[model samples]
Target: MIRRLAAFARPFSAWLAASAALRVLHLALGIAILTVAARALAAGADAVATAGTIVVLAAAKGTAHYGEQYLGHRVAFTVLARLRTDFFDALARQAPGVLHRHRSGDLAARATADVNRVEVFYAHTIAPALAAVVVALGSAGYLAAAAHPALAVISLAGAAVSGLAVPLLGRRPVRQAARRRQETRGLIAAHVADTVGGLRDLALLGAAGRWERRLGALEERAAGDTRALAARLAIRRAANTAVLAATVSAVAVAGACLWRDGQLDRQSWWAAIAVTLAMAPALTAVEAFAGESGTTVAAARRIFEIIDVPRPRVPPPPAPAPPGPSGSAPPRPAPPARAATTGPATTTGPTIIGPTIIGPTVIGPTVTGAASPAAAERRAAAVSARGVGFAYPGSPPVLAGVDLDLPPGSTTAVLGATGSGKSSLGYLLAAVLTPTHGTITLDGADLRDLPEDLIRRRVALADQRPFVFSDTIAGNLRLADPGADEDLLWHVLETVDLAEAVRALPGRLRTRLAEHGADLSGGELQRLSLAQALLRRPALLICDEVTGQLDAATEARLLDRLRRDSAGRTTVWITHRPATLRAVDQVVVLDAGRVTTPAGPRLSRAGAARPGLSPAGSPGPASLGDTPGPRGPAG
Candidate 1:
C-alpha cells in the first residue's frame, strides 16, 4: 500500500520537489537572518549593512513561503484527485457483488472522509519531514564550522528526542484512539443514511425513537474517542516543548563554557547559539507531524482495504494469431473467439469490438419465413442453465442444482414462495450473478465468457423495486438509449401503456421526477421502469415483479403489449401472480433453494384463460406437468 501511494505522487513529483526545496530555502534564510542580527549586536560592525542584509533575507523567506505553500497544495490536490479516481474505479469493479458485503454508509465514508485524511500524509508529512532533515543537518554544520562541534552534537541529539522519541512515546495510544474514531464515524454515517432513506417507515412503525437513541450512542462514542486522542496529543506537545527549551538552554550554556575555555570568540559564540534557536522551529515542525502520523497511517490502511478487493476475473481478449506467409487469402475474419484461455468455458459469436449501441441492428440473427418478427426476436437469445447453484460466502446455498432453458422468443414465468430463490434465479439468468457450481450460457456462449457490455446490451432486468433518478423524463430514458430521439422515447412509452400519462404531465417528457420516483404514483413508476426496459429492446428481458404495483387491468394490458413488442425476445417473468403466469409459454416453480417443478406448467399463448393457473382456474399439480418443458444441461 505504501508503494502504491508513492506511485500517486509520481505524477506531481516536480511540484513536490519544488515545494520541498522552497521549504529548505525558507528555513535557511531564517537562520541566515538570525546569524546576521547576532553578529551586528555582538561586534557592532557595519550595522547599516547588517540591517540591509536582514531585510533582504526576510523578503526572500517570505517569497519562499508563498511558493512552498502554492506548490505544496497543488501537489496535494493532484494526488488527492488521482486517489479518488483510482479508488472509485476499484470500487466499481467490485460493485453489486463484493459491495453487498459492505455497509453503504461505511463505503461512502471511505470514499470521502478516509480519502481526505490521506492528504495529511502527502501535504503535511513527506515534504515537511524532508525540509526538517535538511534544516537540521545545515544547522549542525554551521555550529561545527564556528568551532563548536560539541554544541552541534547537542543540537542534533535534541532534535532526535523531540521529533522521534516524543512521537514514539504516544504512538500506541494515539493509533488506538484514531482507529476507534474512524470506525465510529463510519457507523454514524451509515445509521444516518439508513434513517433518512427509511424515515417514513420508521415513523409508521413507531421505531424512530429507537433509531435516534442508537445514533446518539454512536455519536457519543465518537466524541469520547476524539477527546481521548486530543488529550494524549496535548501531553505529547507539552513534553516536546519542554525538551526543545532545554536543548536551547543547553546550547547557550555549552557555548559560554567553550568561550571561557578560549575555543570561541564573542561573535562566533552568539552566532552558534542563534543557529541552535533557529533549529528549534524546524524540529518542532517534525514533532507536530509525528504527533498526527498515527491517525494518518490509520486512514491510509482503510483506503488500501477498499483498493485491494479482489476483482472479478475477467479474461483478457484473445490475441490474434500471426498471419501466414505473405499472400495467403487474407485470413477470413476469425470467428468470434472465446475469452482468454484462462476462461472456464468457450464462447462464440460476433464479438462486439467497440462502443456499439444495442438495438434491433445488433441482436442475434432472426429465423425467416413463417415466423413473425416477434417470434424471430424471441429467438435472438437461447439461454440455458445447467445444475447451477449460488451461495453467499460462508452461507449455505441459496440456489442448488437448478436446470433451466429459455428458448428464444419464449415467455417463461418463474414462480416460488418468498425466500425460495425466485429472484436469485432471475439474477442468474440475467447474467448479473455468476453461478458457483455450473454454467449459464447465452446463445451457446458461456455467460462468463461474454463481455459485460454485450451482456448489458443483450439482457435487461427490471428490478423488484426499480430506481428512478431525480431527472427529467427524457434524462431517465436516455440512460437506456443515450442516442434515442424523442420519437423513439415516445414509441417505447406508448408500448408500455405510459404514453398517455406522460403526455398529460405538465412538461411531458421534460417533466422532472423526485428521487426514487417520489413524485410519481407507484404504478406510474412501474410503467416508467417498463418503458425504460422496452426502450432497450433487449434480446432477453427479465422482469422481476415489475407489475406488482399495477392493477389487474393495467398489468394485463401491459403484459399484452409486452407480448407484442417483444416478439423475438426471451422474457423471464418472475412472479407468483396467477394472472401473469397464464400468458407465458412455460412456468418454473421453485421451493426452498431448489426447483421443485423442473418441467413446470406449459400454456398455449393463444388458449390460456387464466393468467398463471390451470384451465379450470386452480393452481393444481396437473397444470405444472401437463406438458414436457425445455429441460437439459446448458449448451
Candidate 2:
C-alpha cells in the first residue's frame, strides 16, 4: 500500500531527491559542529577560532534546512493539486451512476480532508526518515574509530530505540485508531452536508432537533477516535525519552571506565559524548514521523480508492461489411416487433454499447417512407431502440427488452406506473445511463459511436428537478449556450412562456436566483429549466414531467409554445398525467420492464399509433387514472 501511494511521487522524483539530500546535509553539518566544538574546548584550543568554525557550520546547516523545507512543500502542494484533478475526473467518468451509490458529503470529505492529510508523507515523513538513518549510522561509525567501539554500540542503541523500536511497538494499535478516526471524520462531513442541504425540510417536518443531535453524536465519535490516536502517540513519546536517558547514562559510565583504563583521552571522550547528543535531534525527528505515519497511511488509502476507479471506456465503432453483388450495401434488418425477455438477448442487428456519450442524440438513417417533406425539412434525427434494458447497480431491472421507433419531428409521450422506468428510459435516451441489453440508435449510428460534444449540442433534457446555480437569470441561461445573445435568450424564454414573468422581476433577465432556484416558485423554476433547454435549439428535446408543478393555464400556454417549437424538432414527454396525453401525438406505456400497447395495427406516419404504443381509444395496463407516486429505481 505504501509503495502504491509512493508511485504518485514519481513525477516529482528530482524534487524529492533534492529535498532528502538537503535534510541529510543539515543533520551531518549539525553533528560536525557539535563534535568540533566539544573537542576544541577539551583541548583548550583558541575560543575565537572554534567560534568562527561553529558559526560557519551553523550557517550552512540553516541554509540546508531552508532548502529542505522549500522543496518538500513545493512537491507536496503540486501532488495535492494533481490528486484533486484526478479525483474529479474519476467522478465525471462514472457520474450520475456513481452518484447513486456515494453520498455527496463522503465524496467531499475525500476531496478536501483526506487528500490534505496525505501531504504529511511528502512534507514530513520521507526526507526525515532518510536523514535519520543516514546520520545515525555515520555517527556510530565515527565513534567506533575516534573514541571507543563500546561507545559506538551505545550511540546506535539510542538511535534504534528512539527511531525504530518504540514506533514499531505501537504501530498496530495506532494504525487502527487512525483508520477509525478517518472513517469517523468522513461520516461527520457527510452528516453536516446533509443537514445543511435539507435544513428547511427538516425544520418544516419538526426534525431539525433530531438531525442536530445526530450530528452531535457523529462529532463525539470523531473526537473519541482522535483521543485514542493521541494517547498512543503520547505513550510512544514517553518511551522514546526514557530510552534516550538510559543510552546517555550508559555512554557516560563506559567513557569514564575507558578513561581510567587509558583507552580514551579527554578530547576524544568529550567528542564521543557530543556525537551521542547529535543523534538526539535526528532520532527525535524520526519518532515524530512514526506517530504521524498511521494517519498518513489511512488518508492515502482513501485518496487512492477514488483515484483508482476505472473510467468508462467507449467501444470502437462497428466495422462496415463488404458491399453486396449489386455494388450497394445490403439493407439492414428492421428491429424486432417486440423484444425478447429471456436472460441475455441475442442481437440480430448492431451490437449495443451502453451509456458512452455525455448526452443523448437521435441520429442515423431516416425512417423510410415515413418522414413528410415538412418533417424532413425540420432536420430532426430519428430515434430507435431495439431490445434496450437497464438496471441500477445491485437493483432490479428498470427497463427490459423495450423497443421504440420515434420518427423525425414527432411528439411521443411515455407513461408508466411508479417504478415503471419512465425516468430511466428518459435518462437512457439522454445517454446519462447505459442500457444493460440491446442497442439505442440515433438515426443509423449507435449512441456509443457519437462524440460527447456532438450529442450534448443536439440533445436536451428538462426534468422536474433541475439544478440552478446561484447566478443572474441571464447568467444561468448562458450555461446552456455560453455564446447565446440577449435577444436569443429572451426569444427562448418567450418560447417557454417565461418572458412576461422575467419582465415583472425587478432585475428582469439580470435578476439573480438563489441556489437551486429557491427564490422562484416551483412552476417558474420548471419553466426556467425548459427555457434553458429551448435555448439550445436541440434536434431532440426531452421533457420529463416538466409541467408537473404548473397550473393548468400555465401548462396549457407552455404546451402551446412547445407545439410551435416542436415544428422543427423531435420531442419526448415522459409523464404519468392524463392531461399530458392530450399534447402528444402518440403514447407508449411501460409495465414491469416491457413496452405494451392496446391491440392495434402499426401506422406509417410519424407520431401515428405504432407497434410500441397504444392508439387513443384503447387503454394500456397502467391507466392514466392511476395515482402517481414517487418514482422508483426504474425511474
- Name the candidate that leads on TM-score: 1
Q: By how many angstroms RMSD does model 2 differ from the true structure? A: 9.2
Positional deviation of residue 102's Cα in model 2 after best superposition, in angstroms:
2.4
Native-structure RMSD, model 1: 10.9
Against the reference, the lDDT scores of all candidates come to 0.72, 0.75
What would the TM-scores of all predictions be? 0.80, 0.79
Error of 2 at 320 (Å): 23
364-422, model 1: which lDDT tens digit per residue?
Answer: 22214423454444445788776678775566677776667677666666766556677
Model 2 lDDT tens row, 46-128 = 99999999999999999999999999999999989988998987776555676787788988999999999988888988889
Identify the runs in model 1 with alpha carbons over 4 angstroms from their true place. 45-51, 97-100, 312-379, 408-410, 442-451, 582-585, 598-635
Task: Report the number of the highest-lDDT candidate.
Answer: 2
